[model samples]
Target: MSTVTLQEKKSYRIMGISLPLFGLITVGVLTATYMEVLPKGMIGAFALMMVLGLILNEVGNHLPIVKDYLGGGSIVIIFGSAALVTYNVLPESAVEIMSNFMRGEGFLDFYIAALITGSILGMNRELLIKASVRYLPAILGGVAVALGLVGLVGAIIGYGAKEAILYIGVPIMGGGMGAGAVPLAQIFGSSLGVDSGEMLSVMVPAVALGNAVAIVVAGLLDRLGKTKPNLTGNGELMELENKKAEAKEEVEEKEEKTAINFPMMGRGLLLAVSFFTLGSIIGKFLPQVHSYAWMIISVAVVKALNILPREYETGAFQWFQFVMTNLTGVLLIGIGVAFTNLQQVIDAFTIQYVLLVAVTIIGCVIGSGIIGKFVGFYPIESSITAGLCMANMGGTGDVAVLSASDRMKLMPFAQISSRIGGAFMLILASTLLRFFI
Candidate 1:
């Protein structure tokens, strides 16, 4: 009689769990959640997020139109979770636990810390140095154009130019929510003698809608790159005509071939957290600057100086890969649950607001693309990083935008655009409020 071998048996998997096992786990999680007996903290948070994220990811990636045009699984996990919460499909207690774990308990920071530390250290020293010098100008170009275009459009439509720039334009390009809208609201409120909460109510929707637009545009850019191959460098930001660039690719290939080292990843975890801690300490002294910007500076300095041993760099990269591969879906779900407000996004969809937001994003693309090309960087990559990333919602937006663009390797530059560029926008908003108000 024919017998089925273990390998020959049919099996399906979702997020590494066999199909049946995944279903059972899902049932258990749902049962516990409904019974109000789900374990607290990380255990419960992870279980719910993983199950929901994986399911949404699978559905999103498989749907033909969504997979092709709408940013695939990443967008789905984010907005799907947001929709669930908006409809109150998930219990309030579950949302609270997830939100606490993600924001209150600092899961988002943990994810970003690993990405920044590992991505910088793992990069070629020469490329890192060359790219850094040119990045700022590209960012500035995007900012100038986005704000200027939106202001012009607002004036044309009788929407009040100052209102457009201050409310919609600044917040859209200001980074994300915590680092962008929240601070910008305070600045505007204090300067104009208005309540910060009231100002925030106006700015929050712009940030959210801008974030959504950035993700969609990133996917379109990815498609454009495919159609016009010369406009993009795949994951590489710059189009360098040097052997060093080639050498970087070889190093990356070698890294991929290297065996997984658990101990190395452990060391990587420690190094990432330590660097973040250093940034936090530095941020205390420079209260104006975000700790993330400080962390990027610190990590970049170390990488540029070649201060660490080669093994440590490898460790950091490995750890980053581990976190990115496993936790990204979870993190996206957290963002949707904790940060996104579907009702607010809907409320802010007036024609004038939508038109102004569209203009700002377009200006960012045109401005960053032109300047980036001038600076030897690929236009698509630059626009995605210095432009769309700047226009997105900050750290969480960075993740979504990069994921939509299929350029997760561009995380370092994306972070720079979010943290540093966002800080610059805050300063600009404060100065402009004095002039406009």
Candidate 2:
């Protein structure tokens, strides 16, 4: 009986059940809604995301060619699902339901908040302090190189260096939506005598395209690290001789009754949420800086002061693992369905335009990796934070890129790139727009 039970567990019928059930349920819900009373609320939205997410992700991760060059299942789920809506492959009612749920219902914000809290609290206190000091230079390096390379590509393709930098490159390399393009549209409007809406129309495409490319490149980078063997710390940002120290810590841990319990996970969740709340509260008072920046600051201070004990920290780590393991897929689908517009990417497609954006992302990776190595950080880790984060769509982009790279623990650096590095681009845009104009 036990042998039979084990065999059943390993059967394809049991293992592959999730994908089929997801499809059947999603179709049933959407069809039922169309036929009669609509399941047109949060429940319906979640249903679509889960079904679509599970199916696309399974293919992306399992397919040999796609898992390699296309940046694994996460990217597949995001862009493929996005293409479905963009091309109108999905029903109007289905699209509307998903869009309303993702955008109107605050799904993205909730996901980001959870991600930020857990990643920050889960980091090593000493490592966090060390990494924060040097990560900024890498971000600046990415920005500088991206601008230069993109401008050069533009000139070579007859796009003109100055025109390319102002219209094409700047927006792609800018921080993100709220912090990047929205304000940049205003800057272009006032300084270059272009309509803000027109500038925004140009900028949003660049942002979305660049973000998509960044996620793909990150997967490629992870593969590159596996091949090169010396470029990454696996997931660690530093290559310090901490092995002995880690071993000693492990020995110390064994002496104590330190096992991960549910209470610990709960405490971690509470701590993470509390910090997120603090950042939000601070954002209301000081609207200039993003809530994430404040949250990082608060968490860093708490870690620095040794206010939190080892037990709480462990709980936070466990909770973080749980959240990441479960929700990364769901959120990626939300980004694709709700946030991305495949139509814009398709419309903006041109050889010269594509080359400019491609070089811009490459420049970011090369610039940040080299600078990060020089400043005592892992090259792959640095690029993921400084380059990929800079190129992605602010917070949402940060999560997607990081998830694709399989390095969610690096969320602090990613946020720094999106928030602080993004702010720097705003300043650079103001200064450079005049020269271009």
In candidate 2, stretches whose alpha carbon ends up further than 4 angstroms from where it belongs are 1-7, 12-40, 87-89, 133-140, 151-260, 369-437
Compare the candidates by TM-score and give the number of the best one. Answer: 1
* Per-model root-mean-square deviation over C-alphas: 6.1, 7.4
Model 1, range 1-437, lDDT digits (tens) per residue?
98965445478777656777777889999999888787889999998998898999999889885664445676677779989998999999999999899857878778878877886677667645555577888998898899999999999999988989999999999877655665566567656777654576677667767777888899999999999999999988878673244555432312334578999999999999999899879968974555665776788788879999988898998998898788878887886787666666567679999889888999999899989898878999999999999998666678878988999998878877875677567667756765785
Model 1 / residue 152 / CA error / Å: 4.5
Please write out the lDDT profile of model 2 over residues 1-437, one tens digit for every residue.
34644324443431256434544676886676566455778777766677677778778867784554344566677678888877877777877777777667866555545555555555556545544576778888888888898888888888889877877778877876555665676567656665554566567667767887898999999999999879998887766664334433321112123566999888887887788789879968974445555665676677667788878877766776676566666666766766655665566678888788888899999999999888777899889988889988776678778888998877767766765576567667767864665
Q: lDDT of candidate 1? A: 0.79
lDDT of 2 at 217: 92
By summed lDDT, the worst window of 10 consecutive residues in model 2 runs over 247-256
Q: Count backbone overlaps in model 1.
A: 3
**TM-scores for candidates 1 onward, in order:** 0.72, 0.64
Residue 261 of model 1, lDDT score = 93
Task: Supply the TM-score for candidate 2.
Answer: 0.64
